[model samples]
Target: MATIASQVVLHPTVSQSLKYGSTTLGRDKAYRAIQYFARFYAWYLLSKGDKDAAARWNALKTHLGTARKLLRLGKPMEHLQAALRACLSTGPAVEQVTTIARQISYFGYLTFDAFVWANSIKFWTLNPETSTRVAKISNRFWFAGILFSIVNGVTKSVRLARETKKLQSTQKWGEKTLAAEAERETRLSVLLAAQENTRHQLIIDLLDAWIPATALGITNLNEGALGIFGLITSLIAAQKQWEAVNGKK
Candidate 1:
């Protein structure tokens, strides 16, 4: 047991505790050491005038404060892990709200195409023979894609909100149990959002590629510029969406 213990690796701060002190020291000393390290890091960031980092540091202090309390009560590793897991599982509300806003804005852009396509009569003024039929068909396809996107967003938001509410209600649960519950809900939300995002991408592909190609076939110049713009914006939106789901910046 002594040989195995000698080979064990703790985090740098934890290892520092053992180096500076001894194993016989109370666990509270370990907790205090960790707390002091976090506070110093937070202070360094604040001194550099980083408000965002400072806020994050404050939140970390809150989480570590909880951990320190748990250690003082002599809670086991399992309880400590649970508290940390719950703290890390949360994604800010601002992120989700921003995503929803972008989705709505994309819907508005598609609506612009819908309006252009619906006015097939204007196309007839440019070319009397084929423009009218082509315009009507193009309008129908754009409208269908737009409507599908709207429904997808609304349903996904409602489902996520319901699940989030259910998760929030478990705040009073025991440490281990609440951690498991929060992790489960977080995973479920990600999966659900991912599935819907896939569907949304399909709709966007139709709008950006298919409808634009059709528009170029019918109206020529006016719709061509819009198509190019749509393609560019769709690519940007796709990158953002992918990053959001993958938990990247």
Candidate 2:
């Protein structure tokens, strides 16, 4: 029993989890999953006429959201730096432009969101109308960022498809002049991996876009649907973060 306890305490999974949760992004993703779950559960409770239970879950969701906003206080600068880096990186023109635009939009969103957080905490109060306007602006920027991301993903996917087709055709050449078979295979593998990543990101962006869209009054999805979408995207992001923390490919 002592050995089993020791083994459990020293487990690699436990260590990996600690490492993952140590990062702000990782913790935020975890909290986001719970927040959205609470949102959905609250909606469910309300539908069943359990106002008391629903209010509790709704309060949990709201509190987690406020905490997350606090956690993101320093993120605007990160996005600004990312936008600068994207400007310098070399890629297809469409990709380069969209990446930079997306980063800049996120920078704007986070900057405005910081003010919203401040208002929530009574650090400084905006008039009610002004606060609502600020929140809407933040949502608009977030929506734009996600839209840019979707555009980038679609463009990249198309380009990757073309490259993949060309590579496959070259492989069918009768002579061995087509690059070494091993090298060709390696390239194909890389392209396929990239395509997969792009598709995964596109799906995430599409689901997340609805969140800000609804907030901005561009969509009318209910809290339950929005909660489910947010939860799905958060889990997908968390899975990637977990794999990164654990050094898994």
Residues forming the 10-long window of minimal summed lDDT in candidate 2: 170-179
Model 2 ranges off by over 4 Å: 172-179
RMSD of 1: 24.1
Tens digits of lDDT, candidate 1, 1-249: 876666565455556544434432233344444444455566667768897987786676556545544333322333345435534555645434434444443444334333333343243143544545544554554444455444545655566667656655655554577777777777777866665565555455544444434444653433334434354544545444434434454
* Candidate 1 Cα deviation (angstroms), residue 24: 62
Worst 10 residues of 1 by lDDT: 70-79
What lDDT is reached at residue 233 by model 1? 42
TM-score for candidate 1, please give it.
0.31
Question: Over the stretch 106-163, how does candidate 2's per-residue lDDT look in tens digits?
Answer: 9999999999999999999999999999999999999999999999999999999999
Model 2 misses residue 53 by how many Å? Answer: 1.2
How many residue pairs clash (N, CA or C atoms closer than 3 angstroms) in each of the candidate models, in the order given? 0, 0
Q: List the residue pairs that clash in candidate 1.
A: none
lDDT of 1: 0.49
Best candidate, lDDT: 2
